[model samples]
Structures are given as C-alpha cells and as structure tokens.
Target: MMAFYFSRLVEIFPFFLRGLWMTTKVAFCSLIICTLIGFILGMLRSSNIVFLKRLIGTYVAFARGTPFVVQIFIVFFIFPEWGLQLEAFPAALLAMAIMGSAFICEIVAGGINAVHNGQWEAASSSGLTKLQQLRLVIIPQAMKVIVPPLVGQYVLLIKDTSVVSVIGVMELTRVGWVTVVRIPEGLMVFALVGILYFSISYPLILLSNYLERRMAI
Candidate 1:
C-alpha cells in the first residue's frame, strides 16, 4: 500500500512543485517588504523622538504578542468588515508582512542599540547630520549584529508560510493537506512537506550560522 501511494505521489510531484513555487513567491515578496518596513520602523523605534518611539513600540508589542495564526484570521476575515476586501493570496502576504516586520524591526532595533554610545557621539561630533550618521556610520556597524538573526528570522518567515495555508492560498503545506485527504497517507504526505520546507530553509540556516560565526570573529 505504501509503495502504491508512493508511486501516486511521484505522479503528482508536479503539483507539489507548484505549491513550492507559490511558497517561494510569498516568502520572497514578504521578506523584501518586511525588511524595508522593518528597517524604517526600527530606526524610528531607536530614535530619540519620544512619540514616534512609543507609537512604534506599541505596534511592535501588539504584533509580537499575538499568535500569527490569529493575525492571519484577522487579516483574512475581519478586514472585510471594515471595508477592506482582500483575496486569500494578498491577505496571506499582508499577514506575512505585518508579522514579519514586527520581528525584523526588533532585530534591527536591537542591532542599532547594541552599538556603543561612543559611536553615536563620534558621529555627532564630526558634524554628520542625523541621517548621515545612520547612513554612513551607525547602520553599517549595526549590520554585523543584524545579519545573522535576520537570516534566522527569514527561516521562521518561510515556515510561517505554512500557517498562511489556513486561508486557502494553496502553498506547500496546503497542497500536503489536500493530498493527504486523497492519498489517505498522512505520514507520507507530510514527510514530503517537511522535506520541501527543509530544502528551502536549510540553506538559510547554514547562512545564519555562517554569519554568526563570522560576526563573532
């Protein structure tokens, strides 16, 4: 029976490939959006402007505190009540962007905060404008602290793509669920799902480790 199911899976391999492609598309687009938004919010969170700092902090706290699945539900189901209609794929991407940016924001904020006070002082004393200080001095130094965890967060983001399946986006995990119903082989179906996820995430895991080591040196 297992052999027969395995053959069936092989025959439908292209279906899995399609799901993988969808997952890749979501992950890539969301990561890019997250990184940009996160860096901006992070810089704001790290700023001396009290109102901006507090406001961004509240947003980050809310985003980080809630479960991502709940967030997805809100985006998919609730927003329409407020007159924002979204399809499943866009909602999934929106959820990913919202959740991922909160995490990446903290990573960037922490990296910025980790830089010594003296560095900021030096930049200021050199007559660099606030933007120039960040652009020319602070952020470059902060990247060493940021890159490792940012890569790791990317792995988490990739896995979180699975959760978006709840909204019917037909990514890899959704494909696995649909296949299992037909194949009646949970282990085989999900094992392939796991392998696909690993294939996507493992290189990122390696890159994170490499960055950690290199940054530590």
Candidate 2:
C-alpha cells in the first residue's frame, strides 16, 4: 500500500506543480505589494511627522499584534458581512499584504532609524528636500541595515503562503491536504509538500545569509 500510494503521488505530481505555481504567484505578488507599502509606511513612520507616525504605528500594532491566521479569517470570513466580498485568492493576497507589510514596515523603520541623525542633518544642509534626502542619502545608507532582515522577512512571508490554504487558495499545503485524503499517507504527502516549500524558500535563505554576511562587513 505504501508503494501504491507512492506511485499514486508520482502520478499526481503535476497537480503539485500546479499548486506550486499558485503558491509562487501568491508569494510573488504579495511580496511586491508588501515591499512597496512597507517602504512607504516605514519612511513615513521614521519621519518627524507625529500624526503619520501615530497612525501608522496603530496599524502596525494591529497587524503585528494579531495572529496571521486570525487576520486571514477576518479577511475571508468576516468581511462579507460588511458587504466586502472577495474571492479566495484575492482574500489571501489581502491578508498577506496586511500582515507582511506591517512586519516589513517595522523592519524598514528600524533600518531608517539606525542611520545616524547626522546623516539627515548633513543631507538637509546640502539643500536636499526630504524626498531627495531619503533617495540620495538616507535610504542608501539604510539598505545595509535593511536588506538582510528584509530578505529574511520575505522568506517568512513565502512560508506564510501556506496559511492561505485555510481559505481554499489551493497552495502547496492545500495540495498536500487534498492529496493525503486520497493517498492515506500523511507523512509522504506532506513531505512532498515540505520539499516543494523548501525548494522555493532555500534560495531566499541563501540570499539572506549572503546579505547578512555582506552587511556585517
């Protein structure tokens, strides 16, 4: 029976590939959105503007404070009652965007803050506007502080894609769940799932390590 199930898994390998594809799509899209929003929010949070800082701080607190799966459920289940109906895929992306951006926001804000105030003062003395200062001076200096942890956060976000399986997003974990029912071999099915996840995450892990080493230098 083990051999039979193993063979069955082999035959349905393509299905897993499809799930992998979906997982990739979700992870990629969410990462892009998260990075962009996180940077903007991070920059604003790091700014001297008190109101923007407070507003973003509240948002960050909510997103970081709550469990991700609970956030996913709120987006998928609760929003419909408020007349916002989203399909599973979009809902997954929304939840990811919310959670990922909050974490990245903190990372970026911390990075920006790590840059000495003298850098900002020097940039200002050079007649650079706030935006110009960030673009030409602050952000570049902060990149060393930011890139490693940002990449590490990306790996976490990618793994978090599996949580969207709870919403029927048909990602790798979902594929494993469905397969296990038919194959009746939980370990084998999920080992395959884990391997697929590792394949995607391992490269990012390597990149994160590389960035950390480079940053430390």
* Per-prediction tally of clashes: 0, 0
Query: What is the C-alpha lDDT profile of model 2 across 1-217, one tens digit per residue?
Result: 8999899999999999999999999999999999999999999999999999999999999999999999999999999999999999999999999999999999999999999999999999999998999999999999999999999999999999999999899989999999888999999999999999999999999999998998999
Cα deviation at 146, candidate 1, in Å, is 0.7
Instruction: Evaluate all candidate structures by whole-model CA lDDT and list the values in order.
Output: 0.96, 0.96
What would the per-residue lDDT of candidate 1 be over residues 129-172, giving only the tens digit for each residue? 99999999999999999999999999999999999999999999
Clashing residue pairs for model 2: none
Model 2 TM-score?
Answer: 0.98
lDDT of 1 at 19: 99
The 10-residue segment with the lowest total lDDT in model 2: 175-184
Error of 1 at 196 (Å): 0.7
Candidate that would win on lDDT: 2
